[model samples]
Target: MLSLRGVRKSYGGTPALRPVDLDLVAGELVVLTGPSGSGKSTLLMIAGGWETPDGGEIVPRPPLPEVPVDRMSWRDLGFVPQSISLFEELTLADNLALARGGPGGAELLEALELGHLAARRPGEVSRGEQQRAAVARALVAAPSLVIADEPTSHQDHRRARLVLDLLRAAAVRGAAVLIASHDAAVVSRADREIRLDAPAVAPG
Candidate 1:
């Protein structure tokens, strides 16, 4: 569902991703793995159309629509960013309701074990709960492609496994799932793995 060729990115003289190539297809879950500063998150951002790359190209396959990735609606591109951005003003269920119109939000909350806390706002829950909620919201819409950055960063083993299973299920249903994660549990469960490197720095 997505392809990147020779993609490069930099910020204020700092290198993020350097000449990276990646491909994501339906019915598969791909995980990006690397150390800090290796640009895993940057790659996810570029792939999601959230951050423009300085060079190279990002291509989408059929069913991904021919329009610009950024222009695609939320239902077509489910992105769970590295930083949790759940709405504090709305209850957990309501936050998911924004992406999905109906009971899907509730179903996701229940699956993530957040059903009893559906009425709680983001601020009222633990960080892990909020993180799972974010993941739930992204999956609620059942988008054609899913991009998640450090999705299981806040979870323990069991919870992390739960999240991974849901993502795998999404891929099984024919949606391409791309995730940036360093957690071994997350990487071990993916159908494929992409390793990135930190760009070399010139002497100042």
Candidate 2:
């Protein structure tokens, strides 16, 4: 559904990414893995249109005529950043509801084992719980393209598995899922893996 051709990025004098190409299709789960600072997040940001690549372009496949053109673009994309970015003032359930723009927050909370914490604010919850809530929010919208950065970093094995299962379920439901992580379990469960080589530092 989406493709990045010859994407590259740099910060100041350092090259963060170099001519990376990626393709994402419905019902597939792909993992992006590499060492720290290898541009996994950069690539994702570019894919989600949050970051402008220094070179190359993100080409999205044309949508069917019945689908509104405005809804065909980034509106169908969802992102879960490395940091848990829930609304601090809202309860967990409320945050999820806002993401979903309707009911069903309760069901998602229950599925993620977060129903008990639904009434609490993000600040009141543990990082792991907050992480799960973040994941829930991302998937709550049932977007066509899901991009997650280090989604399992804060969860235990069981919770990590739960997150993976949720992501996989999203794929089964025809959302193209791309996750950036160093976690072995996450990588193992993915349908495909793309590794970014270490970024090269530009000469002084």
Q: Which number leads on TM-score? A: 2
Q: What TM-score would candidate 2 get against the native? A: 0.91
Supply candidate 2's per-residue lDDT for 136.
88
Worst 10 residues of 2 by lDDT: 64-73
Candidate 1 local Cα displacement, residue 164, angstroms? 0.7
Candidate 2 local Cα displacement, residue 152, angstroms: 0.6
For residues 111-194, write the lDDT of model 2, one tens digit per residue: 889999999999999999998988888888899989899999999999999999999999999999999999999999999999
Where model 1 places Cα greater than 4 Å from the true spot, the runs are: 61-73
Please report how far candidate 2 places residue 139 from its true position, in Å: 0.5
lDDT of 1 by residue, 1-204 (tens): 688998888899777788899988899999998878888888877787767888998885223334333322357777777667887888898888876866557877888899999999989999999989988888888888888889999999999988888999999999999999889998889889988875546448
TM agreement with the true structure for every prediction: 0.90, 0.91
Q: Candidate 2 clashing pairs?
A: none
Clashing residue pairs in candidate 1 (N, C-alpha, C atoms within 3 angstroms):
none
